[model samples]
Target chain A: MNTLRRSVSLIALVAVAACSKKQPPAPAPAPAPAPAPRVNQDSIDRANAAKAAAAAEAERQRLAAATAAEASRLDAARTAARAKLGMVIYFDYDKDEIREDQRVTLDAKVPILNANPDVKMRIAGHTDDRGSDEYNLALGQRRAAAVRRYMAARGVADGRFEVVSFGEQRPASPGESEDAWAKNRRAEFEITGGGTALKVP
Target chain B: MIKSARLLCVCCVCGLLSGLTPAQTRAQDTAVASGVRIGLTYDRHGKPGIAITPVSGPNADSVRAILIRDFDFSDRITVIAPDSGEPPTGALNYPLYAKLLATTVVQAVVTPAGALHVAVHDVAQKRVALVLDIALPTPAYSGDWRAVVHAAADSIEWIVTGQKGIAGTRVMYARNSGRSTQLWTVDSDGANARPVAGTENAMSPDWHPSGKKIVYDLLPDDGRHRIVVRDLTGATPTWSTGAASLNFSPVFTPDGSKVVFAAGNDATDLYEASPGSADPPRRLTSRKGSSNSSPTFSPDGRRIAFTSGLLGHPEVYITDADGSSSELLTASGFGDRLFRSNPAWSPDNRLVAFQSRINDVFQVMTISVRDNSTRQWTSDGANEDPSWAPDGRHLVFVSTRTGTKELWVLDLDTSRARQLTHGGRVQNPAWSPRLELSRQP
Candidate 1:
């Protein structure tokens, strides 16, 4: 019974000492700067360097793809802007009044014009090879003026539009038929300024 | 000798017995020079017979042929073949030509030193009526030959009719060939055609009174039409209105000191500009609700005839030089309102010619200023842009009778029309004034 008591007391003391070694005083705080093993630290440093290099290469590829995409987008936008500006609105024979069907064309221009305040356009009026040249000039002027007035009414400033008339002088079609004449009597829009920076969404 | 004496006696007796008036005396003198007797005179339909002898030199045949063709085109004389039996040199045998009833005999000879001697013999007068000696540097070329022969024909015409011929003058017009329109000038007989203006798509060319300059409208690829005054003497643009809202149908005033044209943005009206002047253009017409254009000054330079839509339809209107006293000139002639444009005042100041639309087809017509009697001059195809010749008896206009637009000249006396230009769409033929002697080539 004595031997058993001694052994139990010794085991308890060893257990207490192990606990104390594992759990030191709370005030002791000097372990953050301790150096790791040299061999293991070298391997860890090489791994981190490789990972960082991979990440940089990935970032460069991403930038190149983004730049190409941006260029393609800008090219497509320029083409679309040119097409929009090239849209022509036809008119009837010996008439300067814009028809109802042509309003849709004019309406499409309003947004583009409003979005680009720096854009300036020339509204040119052309007539079929009918009537006197002088009379045709006046008719073309009236047609161009009608277009300009419509745009001005639709929030476009008057200063942005330059109206001109080419009476029976410039024909869209060379034929003398009614269909050709109809195509010839038209109002065309030409972007005279700020075309280089045009963006179409 | 006896025949000559008898001829002189007969002429004196005829002069005394006829007791002719001044006009009649002039006609008789022309008939005597032509070798036609007074009683056996040719009627208006019958032209005086002329004989052009074969000239002996290089390219003489071509020169003679040109002379024959020109005389035939004159519409006042007939060319007869040379008699088979005739003297080759010296004085002509008037009796032989008299037997053939030839009125005038022309003898042309080319000297060795590139000179041409032309003699006109009057069979009835039994003497030489006129003589001309011209020096030609290049007699072998057709152009030089034609010029010399034209000069000789002009002299003959003057001696016979007391009026100069139009062979030496030129007519400027616009020609479009499915691609572009260019201004060109052709001789009255339609030879030596060449472009005058460098700008393409040119139209409505009007010659200055001096015949040294031309004013026209140029439509560039940029779709801007402007008035351009080109100097033919220097082959350069003396003045141009540049790019305007609308500038067209420019015409020189009678004095040629200013050019009146149509200019506007919304509504075109008449405006005058003095070429080479720093002053801006002066506005002439300002009628509201009316687009006035086609301004043509009168021969007196005091009045202007233009086309106005003030009456709901295009019609001819006359105004003072200051654009006041506007009067409607074509309203009373047409029963109903018709589209009348391209008003060109007659050089004689007696009539105004314009194109009137009837049944949707345009025809050239003229209305008398004094009596208001309208006469239709063209009925075939669509005819527009009538311009009067300097003589006031001929008109040059655009006609589509041959299925294409071409220039045609109409004679007021015979009511006949002759096509001038071949190939290409030609229009707005403005006949230049009588060219000075120095201007003829």
Candidate 2:
């Protein structure tokens, strides 16, 4: 008995909610006003036209609200996606090839970037303090380009991406240790365009 | 062209170079009377001993000390101190200096008339070989008087050897100030270091052909590196590479006409641009799947030497100024790691110096531009960023020999190196061309 009552009440509440969305509150038509005696043809037509216009206006409002809600939702998704897209990928010493261990990092960015076609990006490459600063810059660019190519292959527009190299100029860590060096040889991502609204992958 | 015949104690050479020589060899440095045989060094017999006599005045003691250090840096002359009272002003006791094995003596005085009175005495000839009255930069000890003393020492070197000393020139290097790497200038002797204005995030600095100007890679906010030049006389003009490109390692031609640099879209390639111009840069070198950078020009400006990773690792390469007739300069893939970069062509056009990876560490190496013969220079600690002094016999490079990144000047002739900076991670030293200031007061 309790289950049947709960179902009935739930259905009624849904019906009311749908009504409020479709049209603003108004008294139900009074039994067609007892078939108004000798109503003029022009008056009848005008009344129908006003009712139809009201329905159209209510439909437009519902759609505008739905669109706004959808846009904000996409904006939030893109914000989260941009953060994921910024995740860095590492490379081996003196090597620009994407390492096996770094695939997951790049994989995460690929889907985010693909889903946000309007978003442009700058992929910067960096190196440790071991090699020449100038050549390390080239090496850094190679690493950044490697990341860019990987994304392009995965459907991120190639022209939407730019690569810059910091060489050994910008070290993520300072020292000569293997750990410091490993942390420094990386390609990092930054979003350059496409504001809030983003489609989630 | 001065030929100074000095005998190196066979016993000393035996201990240092594993070769014995008697004092009789007179290991002569008979420099052809053309100019300075700037390539001479102490690794051989060295030069005749010299003495610094007493100078009278308030700053005399400090002046003498500075001059001693300057001459020592030559690596061509051995300095000595006089035992007794100053040589009688009338006649320098040539016998006293000769007996002390100091065949040469130097005398100077901070005269009351406000000049550094310098006299280089040749004990062998029983006469003074050189004399100069240098104008004093007043307030001596508190001012830039050190340069005045260095100039006097250089004059003595000129009289003793054909090569004038580099003491008066300045070095432009970048010092990492924890927050940013800023450009700085110091004497080649490592004194009077000061940061340059507007050089906050700069690196790989090179001097314009005229010592009055400098060019360096400036790191801006958008992550793109820009090529910028500043004049010591107060003009800062930028050589725009592009708004969306990576511009690395910009250096000026010896003639200061075009700025040679490395910039690229997909792969880094060498390029040349006009200073202070916004026009597109002319591409110099390109490869299908490789990166080229660190473009340095030979002294004559006829050839360009740079580093490329076309062979799967960075190696030195040489090409004509127009990027034709390219040939590999240094080929090495030690431990399967092809790490070689920072190619610096020698001022004499005889060698191209670069850093090579060996045993998992970086060391300075120079390859013969004429022949493919290579020589490893610094083996102590990780040494990189080699820049040749105007003399070509001296190279200023960054080294971790002291357990930190410090500036070091290596005298190729003597095979001896000295630290120029202490305490900070200094880098990218560019030895200025011999300027007129070194010859002035």
Candidate 3:
């Protein structure tokens, strides 16, 4: 048992010594020169510099894209607001009251008015030439007022809408038949805010 | 009678100016006043040179009284009862009697036939600074003596003023009765309305630039619309072209060489055709996948505006007559809430008025061409088919807010609107250009 133990210890010492040997003996050939430490340091420095440049380029591209997107967003909003400026609400022939079916249109207008707090509209009422001039004029006034009232109730400020009575003077359709008279009676809205955005439907 | 009429004609012309210096106005008013004296006398025929008595016939006094009353209202003339005489029996030497009247205060003589031979006297020019010979229309004393006198007085006013008198002018328009429309001609102030075309779907009338012809679209029983032009002086109407799919809303070019209209092939498009030919219509607008209709020309003929549906919705678009460089003028879904059509340009090309659909209702809207400011010219009723008056101050259109569609007029400056037609539904109005009369020189 003591001889075996001594032999194992000897093998371990031999393995460690063999692995630790740095240079191979070749009949005492010229020993190899040591490499310069600064060469490795220079390589490491170039790698770090390239990485920093890449990160800067990426940041510039991201900023340019953001600016372009912001401009596009502003243009779209402006177009939508201008389009909604002259939206009009129509009515039945000789009738000044708003119909139930027209609620959807009125609802659509609410957003436009709300978004554009400074926008003002002129609500004009028109009638066909079926009645006396004085009567049609009065009816036209009522129709315009009805639209103004509805808009005011729907969160649009009362001061935003002005009423004008064209009476029977201006007919969308100049005729003496039911078809034309039906087309003639109605109310229209003109935007008084943000310049003239009069759109014809 | 012939001699008496000539004397009345001269007096009518001179009498209109005589009242300018009413003894009261001349003495008291703070403006320039001038007066003309008119004398009535009968010419003597086949006599021993004896002056004919002016009050010979029973109708003579009545006619003279009518003339006197009319002359009193004139701005420049006054009726003065001078030496009166019996009416002559037969043919009188008119030139000789007119010469004799020159020696007295008389300026001219009137014949019973209602012809006025105004004397070109040398002394009158030196005296009143007015010397001109005017032949006036003979007034018929039998039916309405007042009418005759008024007619003579109007003639006098015309001689004094270089402006053509409105006494003989006529106004033409379209009238809607029940479901059909008819062409109508009337006096300026809604008097003597007579249907030129018996119950026909006559829409969009235009006066020939010459004012002698009217072009309109007529719909026959076949439901096809055709363009027809009628001679206002006579009865017969001649169709310039055969039936088309829908040849409605016709208007004459400013020069009267061509007619621009909207016709339906699958959709309505603008077309131009010559006045007296069957040439195939020259299409002005292409089928841009939308219904393009209601073409109107500007006064200068450089620009045109029509309703087009190119942007997925019907809207008013302005372009050159040849359809180049077209631009959308109105916003989509406007007047389209119900239905919108008919675009008319003001005479000055400064404004364009159109029908728009709002909330399922049609209304009238106008856009100023200068700054593109849009305003609702009408509200309340189903107003459509707007045509501008020649003066550009008033507009005529169709409306139906009062239970029936009728013709209406709106004065732009005053914003005053009035109903023109009482009954039936009227649509598609085109104001005629000014009319010119061929004077019997």
Candidate 4:
């Protein structure tokens, strides 16, 4: 609005001048625009410097965040692989013989064992509360031995495994239900040595 | 034909069963508690009816109550009711007890000198058969004197029947605590139940022949269980297997010379060593693929009866003490499956008591060693781990008949079971041999 007002006033002044001269007036050349207020060269350079610094800082933070997330993901994957190496395999009632369905679980451990020959494992057998603790101790040993035997047959070295039986003492679940009993009759694996760095199979 | 059932009602009220809690057994003498009929174990037709006469003096009521309960629990010598009225003030009217169908009468009087003056009178002979001056520990209702009273009762049974009773014995078992089973000892009558000192993780305790020590398997967290021998007196250092990977189901040779236990990390097998020495134990069972455990020495210590998981399921087997000539004792089938374990050879060496699975429930049964005749003693619930009283006619076992696992004593002749423990989930009862703290009549 100000610019337009200035322009209108300037045109009026020109027309008045032409009328006072008492000569035929045509559209005169528009007057030259006034000069902008002067700013120093150093000030312009300072503004450019601040903008560039802000952009660099934002880019650096994005790179750090991405790096942290990648490290965390790798850590979680290693932990999961180590836990899988110590997985539990369950059994049928009063049976030490491994079921066909559970073979996949044992099969999963073989490659992990093979990948890390230095690793030593402890395989413990357990039972439901159905039988005598003494008898269950024997039964648990059989189940654990059965597991160890399977691992050995699959090329796991005999020296790399330790077998034990907890009988019905250490149950995976509590109470007297079919589900609890089924969960209790199992062979559990634990890494005895060389477990710090697990190679996922 | 005695009214055994009617008296049994009073006996139950009196907590006549062996392992009922003390609070249950202490509710004694409801007027009819005086006359529980006892049946002699050896004789079938001659029950040998006996009357426990009323006594006089300090703790007379306590003395008479314990005496009568011991005889009633003897499962020998029929206990008849005393005469309705007292005999003439000075003397006992033997004729009255005889008229009550009592073949023998036990007259006890707590004398002024802290002695239970007892006389065993044969009613037919009309003469005093034997006299016992048993020292009566004052304040009999509590403390260890009850054991003395029980011993006095055993003496009476001994003199009258010519065979001693196991009234003075105690039962050892493991009671489940927080995460572990603790060692426990209770009187044979289910009185004086207390945990053995510092045996919180012990399982399956067996009594030493001398009754001065116990052997059990210590359950540690590392899966390296060891057989531990602890002296009850605590005067001697404890003995244990320092190297075995899994040692359990420990028992002492009947002669107290050696300890027999099972060790397995490779395969379950029996092992033996000097009970108090640190010598390496020699392996007893050689079967590699099978689990051979629960070793029980026969009476003469020449043979062992154990549970073997050789053929898919556990079965009872007898082998020489040298671990040779293993023979299957329980081979016949209930229905194509044989699940028998927890073998306890009788003290008389004639019967082997074990648990057999029937309909998925284990029941205590006895197999005659001589003839292979099997008799099932428990039916209502899962009953296993049968340990015999030294008398060979009674047994202590783990039974779930009452809904919780408990220790129960079974009279083989009467097929009667007495609950020995009501604590939380008890198992593996080992009845101690007769603690002969008193003179044999």
Number of the top TM-score candidate: 1
Q: Write the per-residue lDDT of candidate 3 for residues B1-441, one digit (tens) a residue.
A: 112322232222111110011111111111111222334443322211212224322344443443333333222233333444444444444455444443212243455454443222222232222232333333322112222334443454444433222322334566654335677653322223456634255655777767667888775433345777877655577556644444556778888888887665234567888867868879888864455666778989888888765654456789888878788787543532534456789987899998776765567889877777887888877787787766566677778768777767676765757655655545566665554323322
Better of 1 and 3 by TM-score: 1
In angstroms, how far off is B306's CA in candidate 2?
1.2
- What DockQ, between 0 and 1, does each candidate earn? 0.35, 0.40, 0.01, 0.34
Quote model 4's TM-score for chain B. 0.87
Worst 10 residues of 4 chain B by lDDT: B7-16
lDDT of 4 by residue, B1-441 (tens): 001211110001111112212322455532334336443222324667778766788877767777776777787777764535452255567777666777788777878887777777788888877776656443454434666677667766776677878777889898875367788887777766777777877888998887877899888766668788887647443788846556789899999888898887756899999965767899988998888899998999999999888876789999999999999999785555478999999998899999998988888888989999998888888888999888889999888788888888888888766777876588889998777453222
Docking class of 1: acceptable
Clashing pairs in 1: B34-B103
TM-score of candidate 3's A chain against the true A chain: 0.58
Question: Local error of candidate 1 at B223, Å?
Answer: 3.3
Question: How high is the CA lDDT of each candidate model?
Answer: 0.73, 0.74, 0.56, 0.76
Angstrom error of the Cα, residue A11, model 4: value is 43
lDDT of 2 by residue, A14-133 (tens): 567657766665676464432223234546787888888888888888888888888778777766777788888888887889999988887888777766678888899989877777
For each prediction in turn, the share of the native Cα contacts (below 8 Å between chains A and B) that it retains comes to 0.53, 0.66, 0.00, 0.47
- Scanning candidate 3 chain B in windows of ten residues, the lowest lDDT window is B14-23
Comparison by DockQ, 1 against 2, better one:
2
B284-374: candidate 1 lDDT, tens digit per residue? 8888756788888889999999998887668899999988899998876565536899998998899999999876768899998888889
Error of 4 at A43 (Å): 9.8
The candidate 2 chain B region of ten consecutive residues with least summed lDDT is: B9-18
